[model samples]
Target: GAGVSQSPSNKVTEKGKDVELRCDPISGHTALYWYRQSLGQGLEFLIYFQGNSAPDKSGLPSDRFSAERTGGSVSTLTIQRTQQEDSAVYLCASSLALIGTSGRAGGELFFGEGSRLTVL
Candidate 1:
């Protein structure tokens, strides 16, 4: 019955540093997602992983952002050479759907409180 869990609820780093954010999804959930929200901005899709399929990285802002889901349970989002513009709330969500198609059909996303990142 556990929901998505994110670690390092808050992080502040110097510009140009590298940071890693972690996420653990609910059991048996085959779909995982990463999103980011900047100040005064709506949530933006970052990446997606479903089952053993290749992750969708189209949403990542640049080459500095990347993510990986291991064993289909835990996922990590890494921002290399963090920049001021990268400061935002990183959110992780999971769903019972095996594919992203479920959300369009009314499937819901269980989200974590989000990890706030700040680059000074």
Candidate 2:
């Protein structure tokens, strides 16, 4: 019955450091997605997982960005070398598979308060 959860709510880091942010999706939801929203920017798709298959990393800005889903329930987005440009709100969403149109059955996504990353 739990919805998606992200940690830290806010992260401040120096440029060129590494950071890992966590996300927990709702139970029974088989599809998960990660997106980033920079200042005055729209949501940018980062990566997505569907079951045990390879993730879609097409949207990840650079090699420094990566993500993984564990036990098909939780996920973590990692930035290898934090940059000022990476500072933004990372959002996670989940949805049911049947006719899965990106959002969960109530697939609109119950977003976390967001881990606002500030790379100084």
TM-score of each: 0.92, 0.87
Query: Which pairs, if any, clash in model 1?
Result: none
RMSD of each predicted structure: 1.8, 2.6
lDDT of each residue in 20-117, candidate 2, tens digit only: 99988878867777888999999887877886443467889999988888898888899988989999999987766622454425445556667899
- Displacement of residue 49 (Cα, Å) in model 1 is 0.3
lDDT score of model 2?
A: 0.80
lDDT of 1 by residue, 27-48 (tens): 9888888899999999998988
Model 2 pairs in collision: 95-104, 103-107, 104-107
lDDT of each: 0.88, 0.80
Which regions of candidate 1 deviate over 4 angstroms?
98-107
